[model samples]
Target: MAEIETLQELYVDELKDLWSANDQMAKALKKILGQATNGKLKDMLQASQDGIAKHTDVLKALIEGQDEKLKKEHCKGMEGLVAEALKHTVEEAPKTGPVLDAAIIAQYQRMTHYGITGFGTVAAFAKALKLDDDATKLEAAVADMHKGDDLMSELAESAVNVEAVKG
Candidate 1:
């Protein structure tokens, strides 16, 4: 039989998973930014790296404020997503500009979607546990990041690289 976990325990576990995921994302974005040839893509990757660092600090503070230990559980979901992104980035880099941009867009969207879902779920969990302030702050940050991701998608769709691919 599966053992049931208390709300506090579940919250901690989720936070740990999120922390590990963010760390992995930060590392991946740094690598991608270093290898990226497109100026815009490199800039976006750098911005994401900064955002991930800020998010990690926020999560750490939340955990410590609750008197909880900061420990990370492996986030397999993020690992898989990152592995796929790395594969695509390498495979598509040698292609034409539009195709490369398309691949980058697809990879970035996947990561953003993962972040949106993770943060939303964590916020709900915090709310259920009566961590009201944490929930509000985390939700706001997540929402802003989601908005940024949407704007990036729009930019990618209208970019000259995308148009070149279609030409």
Candidate 2:
């Protein structure tokens, strides 16, 4: 028979997985920013980098608060996503304006979706464990990032650079 998993076990495992994912995304985004030629794209990357740092801090506190040691399990999901983003970036490099912008938007959205999923999962786990304060804080942070992701999508769809790519 399969062993049943406790809530604490689930939370700790998921948190470690998420932390690793965030670190991977952070590195990938920084690399993209370094290669980005568009001022607006660079700004977005910088904002995202800051957000990733904040998320890392929160994850660390949550793990430590549970008396768990800070550690990361390899997050294969995030590794795959980051690899794909790097491939796309390399495939479209130096193709500035709309083409480059479209690629950036696509890659950014993928990373954002990954973050949203991770944060939401953590928040739900916190709630299930009756960790009310932690749940609230995690949910708030997730909500803010969700909004940012939506805004980035909107900007990509309507921005001149994206439009230029389609022209």
Candidate 3:
């Protein structure tokens, strides 16, 4: 990673990091998605994988627009999150039922929240740098992530968590 002396440099670096993070997350989701017991949760996880791919495209375009190399710096922050997610969902996973479903949602949301923060910050950076189009696209990505998070919360509250406790 180059030394980020200006906000523009920082923004570009962040976009690269997010690209790597998205790839890591998408791979992990495939593993986690199969572990999901609830049908709705499984569906959501599938959709999230699709969303991550779309967001990666956006990151690629944004990087190209900035004349940066189409390369991703490994995001250690998301590496840690992914490690924890795998540890919880795969290694120390609960029984393959509502209990595991609940745990999956918790880990997914933690990573999603990280995405929300990263995209939101990048959107702000784009705005500060007078990149209106980039800001709009990034904000849209943030909105998509938030919607996914909300749906997860709803599923957890309405079904998964409830079923978890009934066991």
Candidate 4:
């Protein structure tokens, strides 16, 4: 990683980091999605994976727009989150039922919140640098992440959590 001496450098670096994060999260989701029991949860996870891919493309475009190399800095932050997500959802996961589904939702939300924060921060940075177009694109990515988070929350509350409580 290059030393970021200016805000623009930091912003581009973050974009690269986010690109890496999205790739990590997407790979993790592909594994986790198969473990999900709830139909809605499965659908949402699949959709979220698609969204992550789309966001990665956007990040790549943003990096190129900044005349930066189309490369990703490994995001240690997301590396940790992905580790925990896999830990709970796959390694130590409960049987394929509501309990496991509930755990999946929790892990998924943790990852999603990380994305929300990272993208929101980049959007702010873009705005601060008067990069209105970049800011707009990043903010849209943030919104899409939030939408997935909301769907997971709804699935948990409306069904998964309730079913888990019965066990």
Best by lDDT: 3
Judge candidate 3 against the unseen true structure and give its global Cα lDDT, from 0 to 1: 0.96
Work out the TM-score per prediction. 0.89, 0.90, 0.99, 0.98
Off by over 4 Å in 1: 1-4, 91-94, 164-167
* Most TM-score-accurate candidate: 3
User: What order do you get sorting by TM-score, best first?
Assistant: 3, 4, 2, 1
**Per-residue lDDT over 1-167 for candidate 1, one digit per residue giving the tens place of the 0 to 100 score:** 12437877777777778898999887777666655656676777778778888888888888887787777878899999989887887644646666665677677779878988988898998999889999997898797688769777876777835665774
**Candidate 4: where are CA atoms >4 Å away?**
none
- What's the lDDT for residue 97 in model 1? 61
Which tens-of-lDDT digit does each residue in 25-132 have in candidate 3? 999999999899899999999999999999999999999999989999899999999999999999999975999999999999999999999999999999999999
Give each model's whole-structure lDDT: 0.78, 0.81, 0.96, 0.93
- Residue lDDT tens for model 2, 1-167: 12328877888788888889989999998787766655777787899888888988888888899998888878999999999888887655646556666677788889889888888998998999999988987898798788778777777777845566665
lDDT of 3 at 147: 99
Global Cα RMSD, each model: 2.4, 2.6, 0.6, 0.7
As for TM-score, the candidate ahead, 1 or 4, is 4
Query: Which 10 consecutive residues of model 2 have the lowest summed lDDT?
Result: 90-99
TM-score comparison, 1 vs 3, better candidate: 3
Which tens-of-lDDT digit does each residue in 12-109 have in candidate 4? Answer: 99999999999999999999998998898999999998999999999999999999889999999999999999999999999759999999999989
Clashing pairs in 3: none
Better of 2 and 3 by lDDT: 3
